[model samples]
Target chain A: GAGVSQSPSNKVTEKGKDVELRCDPISGHTALYWYRQSLGQGLEFLIYFQGNSAPDKSGLPSDRFSAERTGGSVSTLTIQRTQQEDSAVYLCASSPGINYGYTFGSGTRLTVV
Target chain B: SQELEQSPQSLIVQEGKNLTINCTSSKTLYGLYWYKQKYGEGLIFLMMLQKGGEEKSHEKITAKLDEKKQQSSLHITASQPSHAGIYLCGAVGSNYKLTFGKGTLLTVNP
Candidate 1:
């Protein structure tokens, strides 16, 4: 893809339901990141994937949040038993390498009611 | 935990005016990146600064990293309506993760 692509630009789900957000990073980008932005808040790091290495999950807010990158190209972020607090913009970014500026996708606005 | 603090939570300026936004970090930054985001849109990468005391400019936007590497500023000269958006500063930490400030919302009135 020419740039990072995210699916389901907007999602509204009932609380307790699970949701999956997808990200297709730029071709050959070795680094991928997931971030969540609540209303009027900063971008909060959720997870990071570098090549085939184990993902850095230190930023995940809780065990209910999990992500996986398949074949080092596409990634999926799944939020289990979503809560109202999970309503926010979920952003995905990719870079060629560490310390490089990232290209971010438009993001998925999740609303858990 | 690393934290980035941005000042002037929001600003409204008339077109042709100049404005500056600041971002301070609790810890030394290895990399600082500037991005612009419209409401409900993705972030647009503006610039990246790595070295202490380094400055970079693109068009009317200039970003500077202090020698201490703990703070950065983004200045927009002759602001235009197109510049209205949320300006964010992100810093890369030792863990290779990026942490961002809450952002400064700039409103350039034409």
Candidate 2:
């Protein structure tokens, strides 16, 4: 891909329902990152994947949030029992590695009703 | 807790005016990167500085990292309306995560 791509550019789900967001990073990118952006706010780091190793999930807000990168390419972020506070733009970015500039996706705007 | 803090949460300036935004970190930063985001849009990478006392410029924008490595500044000269957007600074640490500031929203009126 020419740039990072995310699925379901917009999602509207009722509270208590689970939702999944997907990210396909730039080809050959070794580092993938997930961030959440609240309305009129800056991005909040959610998780990061470096190559095929275990992901850095320390940024996840809670246990209900989990992410996995398969084959070090496509990744999925799943949020269970979504809360109104969870409504925000979910962004994905990738870089050759963390030391370089990151290319971000268009982002998925998730809304919990 | 927010590890990074940016000043001037919002600024309104006339076209052709110059402006500067500052970012300070509580911990020493290994790297600092700046990004811009338009309303309802993804972030666009602007610049990155790795070493202290390093400076880089692109067109009308120039960024500098202090020798102390605790602060950074983004200066836009002869700014244009196109430069209107939210500016954010991120600091990378040993944990390999880029902690971002709340951002400074700039509006350049023509």
Candidate 3:
């Protein structure tokens, strides 16, 4: 793709239901990142993937949150047992490397009721 | 923990006016990036600064990294209505994690 692409631009789900967000990074991008943005808040780092290496999950808020990158191109973020606090815009970004600026996707606005 | 603090949580300026936003870090930064986000839109990368005392300009926006490498400032020259958005500053820490500051919302009134 020309830029990072995210699926389900908006999602509204009941609390306790699981939700999945997908990201298709720019072609040939070796670095991918996931972030969450709550209302009036800054971007919160969630996870990072670099090539075929083990993802840096240090930023994941809890065990319920996990992500995986398949074939080093597309990634999926799954939030199990969603909580109201999980309602936010989930953003995905990709870069050539950690030293470069990232190109972000439009993001998926998740709302838990 | 490394953190970035942005000043002037919000600003309202008239079109054609100039404004500056600052981002300070608790730890030395190896790289600083500036991004803008309009309402309901994705972030738009503005500039990236790596070296201390480095400055870069694009169109009407300019960004500078302090000599100490712990601070950065973004300056907008002749602001326009199209520039109304939230400006965020992000920095890469020694751990290789990118942290961002709560953005400064800029509203340029025409």
Candidate 4:
């Protein structure tokens, strides 16, 4: 891809329903990250994946939030039994490696109504 | 606490004026990057700072990093209406995660 691409640019789901956001990072970047932007919480790191290493899930706020990168290319972020507080813009970014700046996707605006 | 803090939550300036936005970190930063986001658009990377006393500029924008103080600043020279947007600063944390500030919104009135 020419740049990082995210799917379902906007979403509105029931409070208890589940939602999945997808990200396709720039080809061969090797590193992918997930972040969330909310009204009052600002922007926060959600998770990160580096090559074949176990993802760093330390930033995931809860068990309801989980992400996985398959084939070291595309990634998906899943939120279960979504809460209103979970409503936010979910952003994905990719970089060549550590210490490198990121190329971010436009993001998926999830609104848990 | 937010590891990164951006000052002047929002600013309004006249066209052709100069303005600066600041980012501060409570802990030492290994690297600092600046980005701009327009309404409904993804962030656009502006510049990155890695060393103390390092400064970089692009066109009418300049960025400076004070590694010792864990701070960075972005200055727009002769601001234009096209420069209106939200400016954010991000850093690589000890754990290797990239964290960002809430952002500073700038509006240039033509």
Q: Please tell me which predicted candidate would have the highest DockQ against the true structure.
A: 1
lDDT of 1 by residue, B50-85 (tens): 999999999999999999999999999999999999
Predictions in order: lDDT: 0.94, 0.91, 0.93, 0.90
lDDT of 3 by residue, A44-67 (tens): 999888875645788899999999
Better-scoring candidate (DockQ), 1 or 4? 1
Error of 2 at A20 (Å): 0.9
Q: Local error of candidate 3 at A34, Å?
A: 0.6
**If the candidates were sorted by their TM-score against the true structure, best first, what order would they fall in?**
3, 1, 2, 4
List the candidates' TM-scores in order: 0.96, 0.96, 0.97, 0.94
Lowest-lDDT window of 10 residues in candidate 2 chain A? A50-59
Fnat per candidate:
0.97, 0.83, 0.78, 0.81
In model 3, pairs of residues that clash are: none
- Over B8-100, each residue of candidate 2 has an lDDT whose tens digit, in order, gives 999999999999999999988799999999987888999999899999999999999999998999999999999999999998788787779
> For model 2, how does the per-residue alpha-carbon lDDT over A14-106 read when each residue is reduced to its tens digit?
999999999999999998999999997678899988975645678899988999899989999999999999999999999897679988898
Least accurate 10 contiguous residues by lDDT in model 4 chain A: A51-60
- Which residue window of length 10 is worst by lDDT in model 1 chain A? A50-59
Each candidate's number of clashing pairs is: 0, 0, 0, 0
Off by over 4 Å in 1: none
